[model samples]
Target: MECSDARMLLVVLMIVVAGSRQASCNVVQFIFGDSLSDVGNNMYLTRSLARPSLPWYGIDFGNGLPNGRFSNGRTVADIIGDKIGLPRPLAFLDPSLNEDIILESGVNYASGGGGILNETGGLFLQRFSLYKQIELFRGTQELIRNKIGAEATDKFFQQSFYIVALGSNDFINNYLLPVYRDSWKYSDDGFNEYLMMTLEQQLKLLHGLGARRLIVFGLGPMGCIPLQRVLTSSGDCQEKTNNLAINFNKAAEKLLQDLSGNLPNTSFRFGDAYDMVNDVISNPDKYGFDNSDSPCCTIGRIRPSLTCIPVSRLCKDRSKYVFWDEYHPSDRANELIADEIIRKLGLSQLNTTNSFSQSTAPSPAPFS
Candidate 1:
């Protein structure tokens, strides 16, 4: 064989070995959710309530400029990506970001106004709901197939990690709003059943499409959000809403357990973000947070400005605060929550698609 051909063969061997050794790195965290998980997908879409274009938004990012993140800097998803040894997952709509990034570390299909239902927001300003995001995920896989061949794409699918964080919008926008009061007739049992069924179908679709390992993030305490507190006039946590979230999470956990049972050795896990955020609310100083009832980003305990910008009021030290705005956790706060999730899953990193320490190469595809 020619020397150049030999050199090319060596490079191929190295790449194959790298991909195999990193089999445990299964997670290419495909994020989907509302403002909490949105990393800027909406910024590239259109003008909507979900867009984050103002100051203090990206203060913590290395760039020191707003990049459409809902926080002062580094969202939970971004921090999780950093911890998992992957590049920050790119917003699916960022023109500068491309398919190479998606193929490498997954994509962020989250939109600020996103919810369970498409009608949750009107057209023009409509965001990518969880369902829509999953559809986009399928498209991403097709992109992979075209770029990396069907065989390699399947290998990536069997080894990659899928992380899902969502559901707040269903509670806040669909249930709480009068526009959907009659439509959804929001009750814990009814809502839980609907969400669980939706989740089950979605998971089944993903599994059929090649997702093996999955980590599901449960809802946080929506009652504690400044929006709920201010809009509902309760000024206290809403037990009913929180209970609904708990029910949804319970049903989801059961569904995941059942799915795992049928999927053989593939691991499907759940993390309780509700408890993590609630713990911060219940015990602030323990987490180094000074306040839970109020956000550091807006005036008093009122909701965040219609347009989240840097010039808007902000806290002096974000690390000392639990939430940056009415609906999102501060960067430090998300880090703590992500740490707990890691501990629960026995993970050393937050963004991995697989635990490189635990996974093995494809394992003969279960058919060979």
Candidate 2:
């Protein structure tokens, strides 16, 4: 061939290869952690706290199945899934949903009793720990590879997003639950550092296994949870407990940013859950919330025993409240929060095809 023809052919080949790589980056989302984003993952498992069979859990979802979600309706994860244009995440343990469904958008590995550490308290029996959850994800991916053949699965791996929404249970169970205080034996700094070490290790492991992007959520205001309010103190929030969450979040933020810098073609980001919860709490009216201090559920005339759903009196207007129960938010509230997160990560308005553009949409409300 002529030299000029050879040069032109090489240029065409390069363009085709680049186009192929971009096409392969089809978005995959994997969710992990506790009740906050549990969806119905906990329901498939045999557990008393499971909510997949109850009222108010899927009031907005049309199908009306509780699906084990711990809210009066859809949780934040559902909203996020919608915003990203994916179906609701399938619970990893759901027997009804096959691996085909689980492998599509992704699988939700979150469990109600999950925690950062194995010994963290108050989790339901047979729940997977954060470490164990990662293992499940790894195993699922491998199963996908075997089912679809390695080449197709490799493309799925590269374009996927992994979300880790955890750490709250670690603080609540290990520190707040009475049963764990004597067993875990962690001082404040000791606990924080230990959790960080586990988190760092987990991120590295995921990265090694082909996770290209991750969003690790920081703990919210633990002291403000209705359950914590009922058990640890009066209506007043415990500043010390909230402070622990803040410390952990700040540290994780720094760690993730550093990890992104060191790793090529890999991004690790922090989800500012702490600020989002605080915003709703500090200025309830701004987000159409009338009460952020107390849950909308009915409580006993004396000490509380149950959440504000099914058996409890639900607020006349769930949108007016920040929390639906002790640890979950109403669907509207979750949609708003998901909007903020989508804006923060610039994940809004994905492309019609598998490609995405930098969102030109107006930024949502500032998180207080």
Candidate 3:
């Protein structure tokens, strides 16, 4: 381990040992990731692609209206929050976010098309990188410190669960695209090493900034997504792409384990969405998914449209489908993904805080 990694971990331990704020029963959540977990951060970015601004995108949400979520209802983050009985963390870009709201439920910095690498989603024109998301959280911490105190803010963060769902876009959007120089700049092995090195710095950055309980989500089988499948003549999952995902997940899982062993009072767990998601595709019936190949919503007679637009053809039954569009999973699949991650990885960090109790009254949203 690097000296800096140890120093960062030391800071976290120091904060915990000296914290005065009483631990609350509620476990606040700070989420960071890509489109799979995006609640609507992309909607605010006018130039970003993959914006679900049309009918049926969010028809099943609590209010039966689109609220920035990409699925028919909730993202994996939403389902996980619901299962834990915690309020959904509001988007960091939401106009009404304030310190009190963050202190209560935390914030979501995940954006549509986001990736671990800063350049991973450049084609999208607008998205938050893992580094930028952490910066936003740092800003949140500063505001909370001013409102409360540094020690109190540190204590609050010490017991909170930090969930990160990224990586897929680093491969799908950047490494694979000829438009991005990453393809020629690094060989397959070199690219993997680059990503690992970058992720290590990012994970350390979060810890140095006061995060203790961190969950880094691994990449699933990108070869199995509807878009990837359609690219092949056989319409089959690309084993080459699957290999990339598997290799990256292995490296990531090791990084998480190494960090956790060296960092005291910190739980660095890996959310292995790869294995379970691969299983779902291999055995659709086992997960109540009948169609795991083609997406539920699509356009085009031969090669399907790259994204789910407002005028895409809708499936008769969305629940039975594994994917919502060419690139993202269905609401049902996201629910299962959340269940698998929580059950297998074990969110013991969430137990650090008794609860993130709900407010008795509505919270007034504050502008950033």
The digit string of per-residue lDDT tens for model 2 on 178-235 reads 6876235777888788888888888888887788878887777888777667665457
Per-model TM-score on C-alpha atoms: 0.84, 0.83, 0.87
Per-residue lDDT of candidate 1, residues 143-211 (tens digit): 878876788777777777677777777777676667775245756677667777887888788788777
What lDDT does candidate 3 reach at residue 242?
A: 95
Q: What are the RMSD figures for all models against the true structure?
A: 8.4, 7.0, 10.2
Instruction: Give the C-alpha miss distance for residue 152 in model 3, angstroms.
Output: 0.7
Instruction: Indicate whether candidate 1 or candidate 2 has the larger TM-score.
Output: 1
lDDT of 3 by residue, 1-368 (tens): 99999999999988876443333446688999998888878888889876777766776665556778777767887777766666678889898898878877889999988888999998888899999999988898899889777777788888777888888898889998888999889988899999999998998888887789788877888999998998888999999889999999899989999998887777888888788899999999998878999888777555576566756777777788899888888878888888898898664334333233332111212112
Q: Which ranges of candidate 3 are over 4 A from the true structure?
A: 1-25, 300-302, 348-368
lDDT of each: 0.72, 0.71, 0.81
Lowest summed lDDT across 10 adjacent residues in model 3 is found at: 359-368
Most TM-score-accurate candidate: 3
Which TM-score value belongs to model 1?
0.84
